[model samples]
Target: MLPYSEEHAQFRDTVRRFVEREVAPHHARWESEGAVDRDLWRKAGDAGLLLTNIPADYGGGDGDFLTSVIMIEEFMRGVFSGPGFRLHSDIVAPYILHLGTEEQKRSILPRMASGETIGAVAMTEPGAGSDLASIRTIARREGNELVVSGQKTFITNGGLADLIVVACKTDPAAGAKGVSLVLVEADRPGFSRGKNLEKIGMKAQDTSELFFDEVRVPASNLLGTEGKGFAHLMTELPRERLLVGIVAVSVMEAALCWTLDHVHERKAFGRPLIEFQNTRFVLAEVKTKVTVARTFLDDCVLRLMRGELDVATAAMAKWWLSDLECEVVDACLQMFGGYGYMREYPIARAYEDARVHRIYAGSNEIMKELVARSL
Candidate 1:
């Protein structure tokens, strides 16, 4: 049976059309500019595509988590990698909804849902890559406010994010127990964004470095309880890892489709490339890998919806699918020959995009260790 319901299928159709109309047409320009247009965010909000799964009371569509999944899958398949909507909708919004106080939720979720405020999470710092306990950023309580001072690097949506959830040590003496998530507005004094960092791929996604030099926010801006940021991150990371797996499977499927089209149309020795024994055999292997990845990803998505997705299972899905994505994209690019290396071709960009899947959302190496721990 398919994992999606009738409602999910209908929603997918809506997202597919939106991607074609709004995202696909302008992606090249966004890629060159190193960031997407701010207007695109508002347009996405107008289409009700920004935060589909948040509550209706918060200006969201109040759809289920599967709604977000459909949107991510559609965006990946459409090759619309610039917007960072998955980070905004699936990751940041959930932190607020699950951990933020009523006042914070009422204040922020509406703007997020409407795209009036772009959100980014600042967890990875200059010193900490995957180790949350090693974060050196500190949030000091002073009277009625918290003073944050530190540097966060490789922050997605960083150049344009109006709101950022910063991970810092509120009590450095307490190790992991000292960590806290603090909300900081971009316009605040002492909070400055560095240049939009140039990247190997996903160039238009506005990744950057953020510096907080004693930036101050009300104590109320703290997300969840103080001294429990690590715990909150642990609770939410399974979903984030699952999101990575979904993107991997989607990209793998798109790459295979693109390759199949190219192989069938391109000729070698007066015959279509697909007619060759070598071409057919290579594609057969890719198809089998993609099919297996998709099936596993679908099962993981369903498990996620049922609140049964464990960390180890999510880790397994993330690493396996991402590795498969890189391998499949590489094979597809080889089929395109020289054209695949040129940026003008989607395969080239897909090749660039596929490399990072193994690095982010907890590196594939980290995923293996997490899985190993379960054994």
Candidate 2:
């Protein structure tokens, strides 16, 4: 059995209660609406469920990495299916806390923790998905203000975010060295929202196309320096990928358990579906794979706690577990027979939602390349 401290277990219980009360009842409605209500964000912030890792001095909960991991795991287990909390709290907030100046942090952190503002990190443009050097978004400083101009697509939390951490080219001549990160407020002129792009799954997430047409912001908004964005991205990616790994493993665990339960209750030929040799073998394989995945993921979590989890390892965990998740879910859906194909079934929804894990936050192929660097 995996080990956990009493405090950690208690924290897990808290997360479960929050999910059961706040997430469970509204998930279907949110899924149908293509976006969750804004009030839920405030509820999470009120409960100290968002940005638990940032220090309490900045209005955060002052929780540890494990707390964030617990939240991710619990959210996945429930298939909460809405909001980009992982993208905001787990992924982007660290960049500001670790790298941004005092002014940047003070300007952004309090609102982020309070859920007074939504946060989004814009790194992927249509032209540059995985390849960072290919980014074409330009940020030119004219006097004391940085003028940003570009279009970013597939931005998570794009429609809802009040603050965006944007990546842009500061010196096109310097290639990868040209990139920089800056904070942009949604209320700023020339910074405008576009259509919420329709997607096959994760419909409640409110993905959108963001256009920055000569959006001008104060010098104080530049995160860190003018040319550290790509390197900063490299530094941040391991954590982001690690978070993705945590989500993948947790969801796979939930899906596996869900399938087992589903098959046991669903009978055919006067015997439960679980009685079939095929079903038993399938579940056995799933159980073993999920256990192995948990083992690796938990080890990664420990290493992350020790500040030793590297980019390559995170990539391995993410790609491998995500592939396993898709496989396990597809098998689970098969056990449901025709019922799984229907949109009303949770498994069917999961099957649809799980398809993108292999593709987003960098494709599995790109993940392999990152891992290959270790050799």
Candidate 3:
């Protein structure tokens, strides 16, 4: 049976059209500028394409998790990798929805839904990568406010984020139990964003460095209970890793399609590249991997919707699918030969974009460690 319902199919069509019209056309410019246009967020919000999984009371579309999945899949298929909509809608918004106070949700989720607020999670510090327990950012409580001080690097959407969910240490001596999540508005004093860090892939997406030099927010900005940030992150990271898996499968499929088209028409030695046994064999292998990954990912998505997805399974999907994505994209790019090496080819960009999948959302090595713990 197909994983999506009729409603999901229609939503997918809508997202596909929006990506083609608003996203694909401007991607080159976004890449050149090192970030997508801020107006694109508003447009996506207006189109009911942002925060689809949030409730209608919060200015969201009242859609399910599948709606967000459709959006991610369509965006990847369209090769619109610049916008951080998945992070905003799927990853960051859920944090506020599931953990934030009533006031915080009322104030923040609506803005996020409306695209007036771009959301980012600040977790990886200059010294801390996947080790959330080692984060040194301090959130000192003072009367009614939290004074946050730390530096966060490799923050996605950092340049354009309006609200950032920051992970910091509320108690220095407690280690993992000391971690806390604080909501800091970008306009707050002592909060500064560094230049958009240029990356090898996903060039249009702004990854940046954020410095919080004694930045303060109301104590109400604390997400969930104090000293429970690690728990909250552990609960939420499965979904984040699943999101990466979704991207991996979608990108793999897109790369396969682009390569198929290229090989069918591009002649080599007076014969189409697809006619070669080597080309056919490589593509067949890629197709098999893509199909398997998609099936596993679809199962994971359904489990996620039912609130039954576990951490170990999510890690499996994340690592395996990302590894498959890199392998497939690299093989596909080889078919394009010299043209693939140039940025003008879609396969070239896909190749570059696929490399980072293995690194981010907790490295594949870390995913293996997570899975090994369950074993």
Candidate 4:
């Protein structure tokens, strides 16, 4: 096991305390409502839990990726159901901070760090999923401003987002080379939101379809250059995937630890379930997988900090650990027998929650494709 720095451990303690007091208690209510309350976002901001990577001048915590990881693990420990603040903070914010002009950052960063503004990256269109290069959203320069058209779907935090990082083709014929990212404010004219989508899992996150109908913004809002979005995305994709991988592994660790506690106390055949050879073996195997997953995840996390983790390795971490999450949760669910199937049970909720791991964050199949490229 890699030794966690004292600072990381201290950060974890802060996150654990915050999660216990502020997040875990309210999570059940949030899940039942199909969306978390907007107020909790401010609470997170006040707690200094959002956007850990941005500099302190921009209203961020000035913390590292590990800080975000600590918060994510604590969030998952509750029930793995919450808004996608971590995604926005760790993935989307970095995109802008690294690429956006000073004016762009000035307009958006403070509110985002305060949690008054939610953020979403609109990359996945109706026709585009993992093939982001194929996205049809276009931004045309008309005189002084850029007019954007097209739609995005399955966007996390879509309905509530104050600004969206829209991926569009500035030159349609340029294919991937033409892609550019633009910041579109949510309240702008011609910007409309679709239904808050209902999904099999992650009910608390507001997933929706967003439309851009001739939405015009100053060219200054263009993130980076006009034709560098693809490169920018390539640079960030690994860290994004790594964040998802971290969440997958952390949640599994929480699940395994919780399940063991339950099984050790829950009686079966007049003996504690842990005494059964089958339960023991199941837990043993699950623990082994989780340990292995953690090792890989931690390595990826460290590499990300050192700026050495690449896109292919990130994809591998995402798919493999998430696949392992499903397997471990499935076995843990079975150990509970009928109770496992009940929505009232954490194991049951976890089982359902684990399903989306294979689908979202570019699906496990796409992950394999990305990993294949490295070979």
Best by lDDT: 3
Q: 1 or 4: which has the higher TM-score?
A: 1
lDDT of 1 by residue, 293-364 (tens): 988988998898899999999999989998888999899899998999998788888888878889988999
| lDDT comparing candidate 1 with the true structure | 0.91
- For residue 79, model 2's alpha carbon misses the true position, in angstroms, by 1.0
State TM-scores per candidate: 0.98, 0.97, 0.98, 0.96
- CA lDDT scores, all candidates in order: 0.91, 0.86, 0.93, 0.85
Shift of residue 125 alpha carbon in model 2, Å: 1.2
For candidate 4, write residues 105-171 as lDDT tens digits. Answer: 8778888898998899989999998888899999999988999999999988987888899999999
Put down candidate 3 lDDT per residue, 204-289, tens digits, no spaces: 99999999999989999999999999999999999999999999998999999999999999998999999999999999999999
> Against the correct fold, how does model 2 do in TM-score?
0.97
For model 3 the local lDDT of residue 173 reads 98
For candidate 2, lDDT tens digit of each residue in 1-375? 345679778888988999999888888888777778999989988988888889988888787888888898888776776878888898778988999888778877888897888999998898889887888999998999999999998989999999999999989899999999988999999999888888888877889889999999987788877898889988888888777778777877887877888888999999999999999999898889888988999898888888998989989987998888889888878988999898777777778878888888888999999999888
How are the candidates ranked when ordered by lDDT, highest leading? 3, 1, 2, 4
Better of 2 and 3 by lDDT: 3
What 10-residue stretch in candidate 2 is worst by lDDT? 1-10
